[model samples]
Every structure is written in structure tokens, then in C-alpha cells.
Target chain A: MISLAGRDILHAWGKFVFTGVGLGLLIGVTLTMAGVYRGMVDDAKALLDNSGADLWVVQKDTLGPYAESSSIYDDVYRGILGMPGVERAANVTYLTMQVRRGESDVRAMVVGVVPGGPGEPGQPGYLVAGRRITRGHYEAVADIATGFQLGEQIQIRRNLYTVVGLTRRMVSSSGDPMVFIPLKDAQEAQFLKDNDAIVQQRRRTAENPAFNRPGVPGLLNAAIASQSANPYVNAVLVQIEPGYSPDDVAEPIRRWKRLQVYTREQMEKILVGKLIATSARQIGMFLVILAIVSAAIVAFIIYTLTLGKVREIAVLKLIGTRNRTIAFMILQQAVGLGVIGFVVGKISATFWAPIFPKYVLLEPGDAARGFVAVVVICVLASVLAIRAALKVDPAEAIGG
Target chain B: MLTKGIRINGLKKRYGKGETAVDALKGVDMQVAPGEVVGLIGPSGSGKSTLLKCLGAVIEPTAGQMTLGDEVIYDDGWKISDLRALRRDKIGFVFQAPYLIPFLDVTDNIALLPMLAGHPNNESRQRALELLKALDVAHRARAMPSHLSGGEQQRVAIARALINRPPVILADEPTAPLDSERALAVIRILNQMARQYETAVIVVTHDEKIVPTFRRIYHIRDGRTNEEAGEGRAFE
Candidate 1:
């Protein structure tokens, strides 16, 4: 037999298409929300991947240097390098701040790395443009997401640095782009006080009689010099030898060095499980709400359409159309609407994902799941309309 | 009792129970021979609709005997297990408004009945086309019901009713929406279709224009029926 549902849809295709478009937009927003959550998890993984470290050694009893503030002496890497199973160790510091470029400023994670070539643990892996930061001070390598070009001047605290290289996908766990500068410059930017504070400290030292009274002129100056310099870094990144596992190298630091050490897997758990857990929950709640709203819209639309055809349905019944046949027709129409909406939604989400401020990772697996969910929702939503249609008495077609 | 047409004896229907009980059909006895067209005329609330519903097998009779062709369909209770199949294969119905499935074209609307009864699509369509040609609606075979004029839609409805070639047909006010000319034309088509297909046709109508064209008439009132002979006016 000819498909009753198909013919009806063709007869009023304009109505069906317009309604599907409206529902498609809602589905698009839902898909984008899921992509946003995936993007956050991806950003966390990218941060770990670009760090190029087998282990992270930080201050004891802390979750950072990424999830919390961690401070260790800059000389700590020297002691870590001497430990067994350790191949190379580098001092690294991270401070999230707004760096100035001409007039506008962009938020980024300023990273301090020792001036070294590609093999260093904390250095950017590869450069897309220009060269690495070879100078000891006032030189920077930036992630391209920050929109910085090579040779551009960027102001960090009280000094200016020239952007010497650009990289891609180098972002902090919080999704802020990373800018690498020489270790000393990052130390000063993270720890140094203003010039006025420095002058005031020197004046106070000169007035102190215990140091300057007699025979201690050099001693007073030495005290002022030591007070003005910064020697602290955030964390030390360690790479283990080929034969040594991260656990083997990390255990020695934790046991004898009195420091906290995290292996790659442990650090990933900290970033993804603890750092972004709340955000994932929030997105999940939004998904549930959108699903309910979609089901409600489908049910209301199908019910109204069935009600409009009550007379035709009664006549079909009186003329010996099976109850299941009518029910199946309504169900098929609902699923057809869902299929149209899903295609439109998938395209809309793909088209607009890049324009979103944060990374929106739309996975093919997620799309497949979303399509199944939409079909199931449509089938469930069609039940109400089917029940109403089946209840219509065939005798109603006669003039009673 | 005749075996090749429609016959009923002491047909009855009741609603509710006890003092609140209402009888919609009381001892409705009627019959129409093969190839004959008859009219059933009545005022409002006179058991005409209830009798039609009973004849259409849409409702059960409290007490009655009904026979279509050689089969005993109802004797106090339903003798046939599947009334739906009985309605599909042994009876046809034409309604007041020519209520064709609006989404379907003229051909598919008429073809739907035979297709529902397990005929192949092409064969069902062929049968529908033959009936459409016989009813002089072949030109509008591809037109949707909404695109057809009133008379054309009625002719399509007539074709749908005759597609299954059932032994009996129940038409309820089949020409209610037509002008006098179209009303007479519908009655004339019904008579011609009934004789050509050798089917028994019972048209329930209050239309005065076509009442005299019937050779037999059954007037229903107060849940009962009275049989009489009509003027047998010619409509050529």
C-alpha cells in the first residue's frame, strides 16, 4: 500500500520543513554544548602533551603548579638532576597574566624556560614561524592563538620583549595561550617589586645602625642586593632516562628530596578529573534539559497533526484500516522529522564551531550517539499521538 | 430468506442499563436484493444512524440476525470472529461528505481498500482505474481530493466504494453537499454502479431530489422501520 504518512508529509512539506528547521536549531545548540565539554577535556590533555615532561616535581602537599600555586627555589632542578634515573631536569614557572601588545592586551600563561633548543623539557616543541627565544632576557615565543606575530613587542610587567617565534595549540590547562620567555625575565615578572619599593628598602638598610655604624659599609650594600633579586621558580620538569620508568625517577625525589612528584597519568587525572569536573557536570545538566525540551516539542507537534486528521482517521477505520497501520504511520512521520532535524543540526554545529571562543571538538562518535538519541526520542514522543488516533471510534464516521 | 444479497431480521441495539437504558435500534428488519438500489429516509433521532452503524458492522446489535450473501454474520451475537475483515471484504460504505483521504490522489484513495485487503499495488490500482473509468472520473485520476470539484470528489468516493465489489454497500447522506443536478447525478451513478457490479446498495438520505428515483424505500422512526414502494422516477 502507498505510505499514508509519506503522502501527508509531501502534501504539506512546507510546514514540515519549517518545523524541522526550528527543531534543528535547538539540536545544534545541544550538540555545540557537548562539543564545548569535549573541548575542555581536550585542552587539558593538550596542556599535558605540550609540557614534554615525564614527571613534575613541585612543593610538598600541593595540587599545582597548574591547579594551584606552587613555589620552589630555582636551584631545586640542580638537585633533581643529580638524582638516579633522571636524564634532564629544567626549571619552569607559570604565571597567568594579561600581556600588552601595542594597545590591546591578551590573557596568557607566561612560562619561564631556560634558554635552550628543542630538546629542553619546558621549551616549545616546534616553531611555526621565526626562531626560538635564544636571548637570555627580553625574548619570547608565543602561541599563534594569541594573535602575536614575530618581531612584535610585548610588555611583561616593567620590561618589553620581542616575540621571536610562534607555535600552535600551545595552551595552558585553563585554555589561555602560552608565551615562553627566558627564565630570569619570568622570575622578575613573577617575583620582583617595583623600583620605588626597592629604593625604600635601600634607604631603610642605610639607616639601620646595626649594619652601617662602623666598618660594615660593604655588608649593608650586600644585604640590599640580596633582598632585590628573585630566586624562586614554580616547578621543575624532569625527563627520565630510556630504561627508567617515571615512577622510578619520581619515587627518589619524593623519598629523599622531601618534595611532591607526579607521574604523567597522575597529573592527567588531576587536570581532567579535578580541575574541570564541575564544568562537565554543568554541561551534562544542560544536555538533559535540551533532550526533554526536544521530546516535548515533538510530542506536541505530532499530537496536533493527528488531531487535525481525526475525521480522515475515523473514515479509514470504518473502511477497515488496521489500528496498527495508523499507529505505524504516525510513528514513521515522527522519525522522519527527527532525521531531518539531525542532519540540519549536524551541519549547523560544524559550521559555527570554529567561531566559538573556546575550542569546540565535535567528535564523530558523539554525532552518532546524538542521532540515535533523537530517533529514540521521536519514537517515544509519537506514542501520545498514536494512542489518541487509535481511540477514535469507527462508528464516528457514520452520522451518529 | 434470500442468500445472495443483504437480509436482516429483528435487529436491535441498546445503550446503558436499567432505567437509564436507551434503545437506539428496535427490531430493524430490512433487505435489498443484488443489483438493486434502495433509500432509507428518516428525521433526526429516529434510529437511522444506529441502523447504519449496525449494518456497517461498526457496532454490535443487542439482538438480531444479519446475513450478507450466503454467510450468516450476526445471530443475536456476532457469528464472524473478525468483523473488520467482514467490513473490508463483504461491505462497502459511502459517507455524507465524500470523506476521501485528503493527502492521497483520486486513484490511490480509491485503490487503498483493495490494497488493504492484500491485493498487489499494481492490481489494486488497476481495479481502481477500471472503477474510475466506469464512474466517468478517469480524467481526474491523478488529482488530489482537495483539487477536485465537489461532484468529482463524490464520483471518486463512489469508485472507492465499488473497488472491492462487496455484496452490500451502506451510503449515509451521500449527496448531502451537492446541488440538485449533482445530487441527481450521484444517485444515478449509484444505481448504475450497483447494477453493473451486481452489488446490493442501501443509500441513507434525506435528500428529496433523489428520493423518488428509488424503487424501494425504508422510513425509520422511533427506533423502528417501515417499508414502502417509491415512485421509481426516471433520472435519464
Candidate 2:
């Protein structure tokens, strides 16, 4: 038999296509919401990957550096480096703040790395342009996501640092691009007080009677010098020997150094599971609402279309068209609409993903699942229209 | 009862119960011979529509007997199982409005009945083409229902009614929407098709212009039918 649904759609192709396009845009938003959630998890993972460390050593009992505030002495890495199965260790500090470029400020995660050469645990893994931070101060490697150019001057705090190198995809767990500065500058940026506060502190220190004992004049200067500097770093990143497991090296650091240690797997859990759990839930709620809204729109459209054909349906029924055939026609139309909408949505999401403010990761597996979901939702949405069609009386076509 | 025609005896239909009951068709008797076109005429509120519905098997006669071409369709209740299949294979209907599926072209509209009866698509279309030629609508076979003129649409509906070659055709107000000349033309086509296919045709109508053409007419009033003879003049 000729397809009733196909012929009807062809008869009014413009209406069918325009309706499908509208539905497709809704499906696109749903898919894009799912992609945004995926991107958050990926950004967290990329942050860990670019750190180039097998283990992370943080202050005792702290979640640290990503999920919570953590502070340890900058000298802790030296002790960790001397441990067995340790190939290298480096001090890393993370401070998420606004940094000045020429006129406008850009939000980025300022990273403090020791001015050792490449292959150090905390330095950026690779640079896309220019060299790494080869100097002890005023040299920086900026992630390309910051829109920074090579050899541009950017101010971290009171000091101006030149962006000597540009890296790609090196972002913090929160998706802020990382600006790599030498450890000294970051330490000063993180902890230094303003000049007025420093002067007041110095006055307060000299007035204290314990330091004015008439024989220890050098003690006040030494104490004041100590107050001007910060010796704490956020975490110590460690690389292990070739044959060592992450857990094997991490246990010794926790035992001997008395600091909290996290292996690669545990750090991933901290970043993905704990750090972004609320945002993930928020996206999940949006996805659920979008699905329900999509189902409703489809149901309304199909119902209106079906209602308009009530007379034809009654005539078809009277002319010996089976109830199954009528139901199938309605179902086929709904699925056809869904197929059109899905294609439009996928194309729309693909074209617009890069322009979003945050990263949007669209995976193939998610798309497969989305296609199945659209079909199933369309089937379910057509049920109301099918029921209405089936309830039509064939006798109505032969009026009294 | 004729072997190739439709016969009904003491057909009854009552709506509701007790004081609110309505006896629409009470003990009505009618028959139409094969290759004969009979007119059922009555004023509004008479039992004409109820009788047509009963002959078409669209409504169950409360206490009656109905037989189509020697097949007993209703004794006290339904004698034939699957009333839907009975309607598809043994009965055809034409209505006041053509009511063709707007999406389908003229050929598919006529071919749909045979297709529903499990005929092959090509064979169904062949049958449809033969009827369309007989009804003088062959040139417009591929046109959609919306594009056809009213007379052309009525002709297509008649072709659709004959496509399955059922033993009986029940046409209710088939000329209600046409002018006097177009009404006579539709009746002529129905008569020609009935004679050609050796099928019984019963037309329920109030069109006074075509009333004198039937050899026999059943005039129904207040739940009963009175048989009478017509002038039997051919519209041609």
C-alpha cells in the first residue's frame, strides 16, 4: 500500500520541514548542554595531564590545590626528591586571579613553576611557540587560550612579566587558561602585603620591647626581613622512576614526609568527582528539563496535525483501513519528524560549539545515545495522537 | 431473497432505554436486485439514514435479518465475523461529500479500496484505471483531490466505490452537493457501473430532479418503508 504518512508529508513539505527545524534547535540545545558537562570533565583531566606528574604531594589532611586551599613549604620537594624511586620533584603553586595584558584584564590561573628547564614536573609539558621560561624571573609561558601573543608584556601583580612562550590546552580544573610565571614572582604575588601595611608592621616590630634589649639590634632587622618573604607553595609535583607504580612512590611520601599524597587515579577523582560535582548536577537537571520540553513540543505538534485530518481518518476507517494502519501512519510521521530534527540539531551543535565561552566536548558515543533517545522520545510522543486517531468512528464518515 | 442482491427483513434499531428510548428504524423491510439501481426517498427525520446505515453494516439492526449475495450477515446478531472485512469485501459506500484523502492522487484514491482488500498494487491500480475510464475521469488520474472539480471528485468517489467490485453499493446523498445536471450525470454513472459489475445499488437521496428515474423506489416515513414504481426514464 502507498504510504499515507509519506504522501501527506510530501503534500505539505514546507510545514513539515519548518516544524522539524524548530524541534531540531531544541534538541541541539539539549545535546550542547550534555557536551558542556563533558567539557568540564575533560578540562579537569587536561589539567592533570599537563602537570606531567605521577603523584601529587600536598599539605597533610588537605584535598588541595584544585578542590581546596593547600599550603606546604617550598623546600618540601627537595626532601621528596631524595626518596627512593623518585626521579624528580618540583614546587607548584596555583592562584586563580585576573592578570593585566595591555588595557583589559583576563581571568586566568597563574601558575608558579621553578625556573628549571623543560621536563620538570610542574612546567608546561610543551610549548606551541617560543621557548620555555628559561630565566629565574620576569619570564612566562602562557596558554594560547588566553589569547596572548609571544613576547607580549603581562603584569602578574606589581611586577611586569613578558610572555616568552605560548602553550596550548594547559588550563586549570576550572577551565581558566594557565599563565606560567617563575616561582619567586608567584610566591610574592600570592602573599606580599601592600607597602603601607609593611611599613606599619615594621614599626610595630621595632616598638616591641623584647627586640630592644640593647644588645640585639640586628634581631629586629632579621625579623623584619623574614616578614617580607613567603616560603610556602601549594603542592609538590613528583615524577617516579620508570618501573615504579604511582601508589608505590606515594605511600613513602605519606609515611616519611608526613604529607598527604595522591596517585594519578586519586587525583582524577578529586578533580572530576569532587571539584565539579555541583556543576555536573546542574547540567544534568537542564538535560532532564530539555527532554521533557522536547517531548511536549512533539506531542503538541503531532496532535494538532492529527486533529486536522480527523475527517480523512474517519473516511479511511470507513473504507476498510485497519486501525493498525492508521496508527502506523501517525507513528511514521512522528519518527520522520524526529529524524529530521536530529540531523538539524547535530549540525547546529557542531557549528556553534567552538564559539561557546567554555569548552564543549561532543563525543561520538554521546551522539549515538542521543539519536536513540530522540527516536524513543518521538515514539512515546506520538502515542497521544495515535490514540486520538484510533478512537475515530468509521460511521462518522456516513453521517445520518 | 435474490441470490446476487441484498435482502433485509424486519430490521430494527432503538437508541437508549425506557422513557428516553428512540426507535429509529422499526421493522423496516427492503431489497434491491443485482444490476438494479433503487432510490430510497424520504423527508428529514424519517428512517432513511438509519436504513442506509443498516444496509452498509455501519450500524447493528436491533432485531433483524440482513443478507448480502446469499451470505447471511445478520440473523439476530452479527452472523458474519469481522464486520470490517465484510465492509471491505462485500459492501461499498459513497457519501454526500467525496471525502477523498487529500494527500493522495485520484488513482490512489480509487485504488485504496482494493489495496485494503489485499489486492496487489499494480492490479489495484489497473482496476482503478478501468473504473476511472468507465466514469470518464481517466484523464485526471494523477490529480490530487484538491485540484479536482466537484463533479470530477464525485466521479472519482464513484470509481472508488466500484474498485473492489463488492456485491452491493450503498450511496447516501451522493448528489447532495451537485447541480441538477451534475446530479443526473452521477446517477447515470452509478447505474452504468451497477449494470456493468452486476452489483446492487441503493441510493438514499432527497434530490427531486433524479427521483423519477428509478424503476423502483422505497419511500420511508416515521420508521417504515412504502414501495412504489417510478417513471424509470434514463437521464440520457
Candidate 3:
């Protein structure tokens, strides 16, 4: 038999198309929400991947430099390097702060890395432009997401550094673009106080007379000099040799060095499972609410559409149209609306993801799952309309 | 002898139970020979609608005997297994308004009954086309009900009723929405179609415009009917 639903839709195509477009926009928002959550997880994973480390050694009993605050003596990597099966070890510091360029500031993760060529642990592995930070103090490699251009000067704490190179997809677990500077500069930016605070500290020490009684002038100055410097790093990034497992290298650091060491798997758990777990749950709750709203809208639309055709339905019933045929008509229309909405939503998400300030990763697998969910939702949503249609009195066609 | 028409005897329908029981149809007896057109006229609150429902098999009667041709359709209880199929195969109906399926084109609207009865697509459509031609609505066969004029939609509705070649047709105020000229024209067409198809037709209406055209009529009031002969005035 001819498709009654198709014919009806064609008969009132203007209404159907307009309604479908409206529903499509809602679906688009739903899809975009899913993309945002996926982007957060991707940013966390990319942070780990770009670090190029097999293990992370941080302060004792701390989660990580990413998920939590960690502090370790900068020289601890020297002890880690002498261990067997250790390929390379480097000290890295992470400080998330506002970095200024000219008049404006951008929130970025400032990474302090030991001077090494590309492929070294704690260094940006690749560049989209310029070169790596070859200098010890003034040169920087900024992630492209920071909107930084080569040869541009940016302020990190009290010192100004020039952006020497650019990288892509290097972000913190919080989705801030990474700016790689030399270890010394990053440590100073992280721990150094202003000139006023330093002067105030010196005066406070000289006036105390604990070390200076006009007899120990040099002793107080020497004590103040040591306090002015920062010799601590946030974490040690370790690269294991081909035959050595990350657990093997990390176990000794945890045992002998008295520091916290995490394998790649453990760090990932910290970043994804703990660092951004609450955000993921929040997005999940939004998805559930959107799904319920979508289902309810579809049910209401289908039910109204069915009610509008009560007379025709009665006529069909009087003419011996089977209950299934009538039910199928309503079902097909609901699915048709969902399909229209899905296409609109997918297109909208793709077009707008880039405009979002944070990275928005839209995975193919997520889209596929989304499509199936929409179809299932449409099928379930059509139930209310189907029941109402089935209950229509065929005798209405005969009249009183 | 039993003919290829509709017959009814001692039909009764009661609503509710015990102290609140009300008999909508006390005892209804009616018949229409094949190729005959008859009128069923009644005032408001009468049992006309209830009897029509019973005759259309939309509702079961408390006690009744009804036959189409030689087949017993209802006797105390339903003799037919599927009343829906029985209605589709053996009965046709034309409402006060066209009540055409709004989603369907004129041709499909008429063809729907035959299609529902398991006839092949081409054959059912051909049957519908022939009826449209007979009803002088062949030119608008492809038009949607919304696109058609009021009179044209009524013609399509009539074609839909006759598409199954049913032995009995129940027309509930088929001309109630028409002007005097159109009302007489519709009655004339109904009479002509009945004689051509050898089908029995019963028109229920309170319209006075076409009342005189019927040679036989059944007037119903307060759950009862009284038979009467009309003037049988010819349509101008």
C-alpha cells in the first residue's frame, strides 16, 4: 500500500519542514553539549601525550602537578637519571596564570622545561612555527591556541619573554593553552616576589638582629640571598628505556627518593578520572535533561499531530484500516522529524565548535551513538501519539 | 425471497443497567430492496443515530436480526466474526459533511475502502476511477479534499461510499450542508446510483428541501419509528 504518512507529510510539507527545522536546532544544542564534554577529556589526554613522558615523579603523597599541587627539589632528577633502565629525566613545573601580550592577557598554563631539543621529556614534541626554546631564560614556545605569534613579547610574572615558536594541541587538563619557557624563568615566575617584597624581606631580616648585631652583617645578607631563590620544581618527567617498564622506573623513585611517582596509566586516571570528573558528570546531567526534553517535545508534537487528524483516523478505521497501519503512520512521521533534527544538529555542532573558546572535540563515535539515541528516542516518543490514535472512535466517522 | 439488499427485524439497544437503564432503540424493523433509495427522517433526541450505529455494526444491539442479501449478519449476537471486515465489505457510508480523508487525494480517498478489502492496487484504483466518472468527479480525481470545492468533495465522498459495491449504504444527512438546488441534485444522484448499482440506500436527514423526493420514508421520535409514503416529487 502507499505510505499514508509520507503522503500526509507531503500534503502539509511546509508545516513539517518548519517543525523539523525547529526540532533540529534543539538536537544541535544537545549534540554540541556532548562535543564539549568530549573536548574536555581530549584536552586532558593531549596534555599527557604532549608531555612525552612515561612516568611522573612529584612531591610525596600528592596526586599530581595537574590535578593537585606538587613540589619537588629541582635536583631530584639527577638522582633519578643514575638509576638503571632510566632513559631520560627532566624537571618540569606547571603554573596556570594570566600571561600578558601588549595590553591584553590570556589565561595559559606556563610550563617550565629544562633546555633540551625536541622529543625530550617535558618539551613540546613538535612545532607549527618557529623553533623550540633554545635559550635558558627569555625564549618561549606557545601553543597556537594562545593566539601568540613568533617574535611577540609576552610577560610572565615580572619578566618579559619573546614567543620563539608555536605548537598545537598542547593544553593543560583545564584546557588552557601551554606556553613552554626555560625551567629557571618558570621557577622564578612561579616563586619569585616583586622588588618591593624582596626589599621588605631584607629589612625585616637585618632588623631582627638574630644573625646581624652589627657584627654579623654578611651573615644576614647571606641568609637573605638563599631565601630569594627557588630551587624546587613541580614534577619530574621520566622517559623509560624500550625494555624497561614505567612501573619499574617509578617504583624506585617512590621508594628511595621518598617522592610520589605515577606511571602513564596512573596519571591518566588522575587527569580524567579525578581532575575533570565533576565536569563530566555535570555534562552527563545536561545530556539526560536534554534527552528528556527532546523526548517530551517529540511526544507532544506527535500527539498534537495525531489529534488534528482524528476525523480522518476515524474514517480510516471505519474503512477497516488495521491498527498497525495507523500506528505506523504516526511512528514514521516522528522518526522523520528526528532524522531532520539530527542532520541539523550535527551540522550546527561542526560549524560552531571552532568558535567556542575552549577546544571542542567532536568524535565520530559519539556522533554515531547520538544518532542511534535520537532514533530510539523518536520511537519511544511516538508511543503517546500512537495510543491516542488507536483509541479514536471509528463511529465518529458515521456521526450522530 | 431474500434479495441482495439490507433487512432488519426486532432490533433493540439498551444503555446502562438496572434502575438507570434506558432503551435507546425500543424495537426497530426496517428493510430496503436492492436498487432502492429510502429516507429515514427523525427529530432530535430520537433513536436515528443509535439505529444507524447498530446498522453500521459500530455497536452491537441487545437483541436484533439483520441480514445483507441471504447472509445473516446479526441475530441476538454478531453472526460475523469481524464486524470491521463486514462493514468494509458489505456497507458504505456518506456523512453530512464529505468527511473525506484530508490527507488523501480524491482518487485515493475513494479507493481506500476497496484497498482495505484486499483488492490489488491497480484494480482498486480502477474501481475508484470508474466510480468517480459515474459521479461526474473524474476531472478532480487527483485533487486533495482541501483543494476541492464543497460540492466536488461531496461527490468524492459519494464515490468513496460506493467504491466497495456494498449491498447497503447509510447516508447520515448527506445533503444537510447544501443549498436547495444542490440538495435536490444530490438526492437525484443518490436515486440514480442506487438503481444503477442495485444497492440499497438509507438517508437520514432533517433537511426539508429533499424530503418530498422520497417515495418511502421512516420518521423516528423518542426511540421509535413510524413508516410513511412521500410525494416522490421529481427533481427539477
Candidate 4:
């Protein structure tokens, strides 16, 4: 038999297509919301991947240095380097701030990396343009997402450093682009006070008799100079020797070194599970609401369409059309509408994803799931219309 | 002799229980022979609709016996387990409003009955084409119901009812929406189709315009029927 539903849709294609487009746009927003959540998780993973660390050693008992503030002495990596199975360790500090470029500024995570050759744990893995940070004090390597060009001088706190290299996908867990500068420069930028505060500190030390007794004249100046320098780093990144498990190296540090150490898996849990959990929940709620709205729209549309055919349906029944046949026609129409909406939604989501400010990672797996969900929703939504159609008495066609 | 058509005996239908009971059909009895067309006339609130519903097998009769061709279809209760199959294979129905499926073309609308009875598409459509030619609607075979005029649509509807060559057809005001001339035309076509297919046709109508066209008619009143002879006027 010819498809009754298909003929009906073709007969009024403009109505079906326009309604599908409207539903498609709503589905697009739902898909984009899921993509946003995936992007957040991807950003967190990218942060860890680019760092090239097997383990992270932070201040004891802290969730940081990504999810929270963490501080340890810059010399902490020296002690971690001597542990068994530890191949390399580097001091790294993260300070999220707005770095100035000409007149405007960009929010970036300024990372302090040891001025070493390639393969340092905290240094950017590879440069896309120019060269890595070769100068110990005044050079910077920035992620291309920061919109910085090669040889551009950017102000980080009081000092100006030339951007010498560019990298891609190097972002902090919060999705801010990373700019790598020499360890000492990042330290000073992180902790240095203005000259006025420094001068006031020196006078305050001099007025104190404990430091400036008449016999010890230089003790006051030495104490004031020590107070002005910063020796703290956010965390130490450690790379274990080949064939050695990170858990092996991290266990001793956690047990003996009086510091918090996390293996790669544990840190991923912290970043994805704890750091972005609330945001994921919020997106999940939006997806649920959009699904319900989509179901409601499909149900209402199908019900109205069926009601319009009451006379025809009664005749069909009187002339011996099966209940299953009538039910199937309505079902096929609903699923057809869902298929149209899905195609439009997928295209719209792909087109608009890049325009979003944050990363929107649209995974193929998620899309497949979304398509199945839409079909199921359409089938469920068609129930109301099918019931209404089936209840139409064939006797009504005879006209009482 | 009992002919190859429809035979009804003591057909009854009641709505609700004691104290509020309403008998819609009070022992309706009628017969229409093959190759003959008959009219059933009644006033409002008469048993016309209830009897039609009973003949169509759309509703169960409280007590009755009905025979189509050689088969006993109803006796106090349904003798056939599948009333839907009975309606599809042994009975045909035509409504006041043509009610051709709007989405379907003229050909498919007529062919749908045979298709529903498991005929292949090509065969069903072939049968429909033959009937459409007989009904003089072969030119508009591809036209949708909306594009057809009222007279054309009713003709197509008659063609649909005759497609399966069922033993009996129940027509409920087949020409109510047409003018007197068109109404006469419909009656003429129904009479021709009934004779050509050797099918029994019972037309339920209140239109005086085409009532005289029937040679015999059954007038229903107060849930009962009385047989009468019609003018048998020719359609000119």
C-alpha cells in the first residue's frame, strides 16, 4: 500500500518543513549545550596534556594549583628530583591575570617555566611560529589563542617581554590561554610590590629596634631585601622514568615529603569531576528541559494533524482500515518530523559552534546519541495522536 | 428464494440499562437482492442510523441474524470472529460526503480497499482503473480529491465502494451534497454499478430529489421499517 503519512507530508510540505525548522533550532541549542560541557572537559584534559607531567606535587592537602590556589617553595622540585623513579622535575607557577598588549589587554594564564631547552615538563611542547623562550629573563612563548604575534612586546606586571614563540591549544584548565615566561620573571611578576610599598617596608624595618640596633647597621637592609623577593611557586611538575608508573613515584612523595601528590588519573578526576561538575549539571538540566519541550511540540503538532483528519479516519475505519495501519501512519509522520529536525539541528550546531566564545567540542558519539533520543522522543510523543485516531468510531462516518 | 444479497431478521440494539434504557433499533428486518438498488427513508431520531450501523457491522446488535450472500454473519452474536475482515471483504460503504482521503489521488483512493485486502499494488490499481472507466472518471485518475468537483468526488467514492465487488453495499446519503440534477446522476450511476457488478445496494437518504428513483424503498419510523414501492422514475 502507498504510504499514507508520506503522501500527507508531501501534500503539506511547507507546513511540515517550517515546523521542523523551528524544532530543529531548539534541538540545535540542546546539542550546543552538550558540546559546551564536552569542551570544558576537553580543556581540562588539554591543560594536563600540554604540561607533559606524570604527576603534580602541590602544597599539602590542596585541590590546586588549577582548581584552587596552591603555593610551595620554588626549591621544592629539587627535593622531588631525587626521589626514585623520578626522571625530571620542574618548578611551575600559574597566575591568571590580564596581560597588556599595546593599549588593550587579554586575560591569560601566565606560566613560569624553567629556562631550559626542549622537553622540559612545564615548557610548551612545540612552537608553531618563531622560537621557544631562549632568553632567561625577557622572552615569552604564548599560545596562539592569546592573539599575540611573534616579536610583540607584552607587559606582564612591571616588566615587558617579547613574544618569541607561538603554540596552539595550550590553555589553562579554566580555558584561558597560557603565556610562558622565564621562572624568575614570572616569580617577580607574581609577588613584586610597587616601589612605594618597598620604600615604606624598608623604613618600617629601620624603625624597629630589633633589626636596626646601633651595632648591626646592615642587618636592617638585608632583612628588608629578603622580604622583597618571592621564592614561592604554585606547583612542581614531575615526569617519571620510562616503564615506571606515576603512582609509584607519587606514593613516596605523598607519604614522606609532607606534600600532596596526584597521579594523572587522580588529577583528571579533580579537574573533570570536581572543578567542572556544577557546570556539567547545569548543562544536563538544560538538555532535559529541551528534550521535554521537543516532545511537547511534536505531540501537539501530531495531535492537531490527526484531529484535522477525523472525517477521513472515520471513513477509513468504516471501509476496513486496520487500527495498526492508522497508528503506523501517525507514527511514521512523527518520526519523519524528528529526522528533519535532527538534520537541521546538527547543521545549525556545527555552524554556530565556532562562533561561541568558549570551546564547543561536538563529538560524533554525542550526536549519534542525540539522534536516537530524538527518534525515541518522537515515537513517544506520537502516542497521544495515535490514541485519538484509534478512538474515532467508524459509525461516525454514517452520520447519526 | 434467498438471493445473493443481504438478509436481516429481528435486528435489535439497546443503549444503557434499566430505568434509563433506550432501544435504538426494535427488531429491524429487511432484505435487498443482488443486482437491485433500494432506498431507506426515515425522519430524524428514527432508527435509520442505528440500523445502518448494524448493517455496516460498526456496532453489535443486541439480538439478530444477518446473512450476506451464502454466509451467516450475525446470529444473536457475531458469527464471524473478525468483523473488520467481513466489512473489508463482504460489505461496502458510501458516505454522504465522499470522504475520499484528501492526500490520495483519485486512483489510490479507489484502489485502497483492494490494497487493504492484500492485493498487490499493480493489481489493485488495475482493478481501480477498470472501475474508474466504468464510472466515467478515468480522465481524472491522477487528480487529488481536492481538485475534483463534488460530482466527480462522489463518483470516485462510488467507484471505491464497488472496487472489491462485495455482496452488499450500504450507502448513507450518497448524494446529499449535490443538486437535484447531480443527485439524479448519482442514483443512475449507483443503479448501473449495482446491475453491472451484480451487487446489492441499500441507499439511506432523506433527499426527495432521488427517492423516486428507487423501485422499492424501506421507510423507517419509531425503530421499525415498512416496505413501499417507489415511482421508479427514470434519470433523464
Best by lDDT: 4
Q: Pick the candidate with the highest TM-score.
A: 2
Model 3, chain A: how large is the TM-score? 0.98
Question: Candidate 4's C-alpha lDDT?
Answer: 0.92
> What's model 4's TM-score?
0.97
Q: Record all residue pairs in model 2 with backbone atoms less than 3 Å apart, i.e. clashing.
A: none
A181: Cα error in model 1, Å:
1.5
* Candidate 1 residue A14 C-alpha distance from true site, Å: 1.1
Q: Give the per-residue lDDT of model 2 (tens digit) for B1-236.
A: 59988988999999789999999988988889999999999999898888887787778889989889988899989998788888888888899999999999999999988887778999999989998999998999999999999999999998888888889999999999999989999999999989999899999999899898899999999898889998789743
| TM-score of each prediction | 0.96, 0.97, 0.97, 0.97
Candidate 1 residue lDDT tens string, B59-120: 99999899999998999999999888888888899999999998999999999988888899
Show the colliding residue pairs in model 3: A28-A345
The candidate, 2 or 4, that scores higher on lDDT is: 4
Give interface RMSD, every candidate, in order.
Answer: 0.9, 1.2, 1.2, 0.9
Task: lDDT for model 2, please.
Answer: 0.91
Q: Which ten residues in a row have the lowest lDDT in candidate 3 chain B?
A: B227-236
- Report the lDDT tens digits of candidate 4 across residue range B154-225: 999999999999999999998899999999999999999999998999999999988889999999998888
Error of 1 at B177 (Å): 0.4
Q: How many pairs collide in each candidate, listed in order?
A: 0, 0, 1, 0
Query: What are the candidates' individual DockQ scores?
Result: 0.76, 0.71, 0.70, 0.77
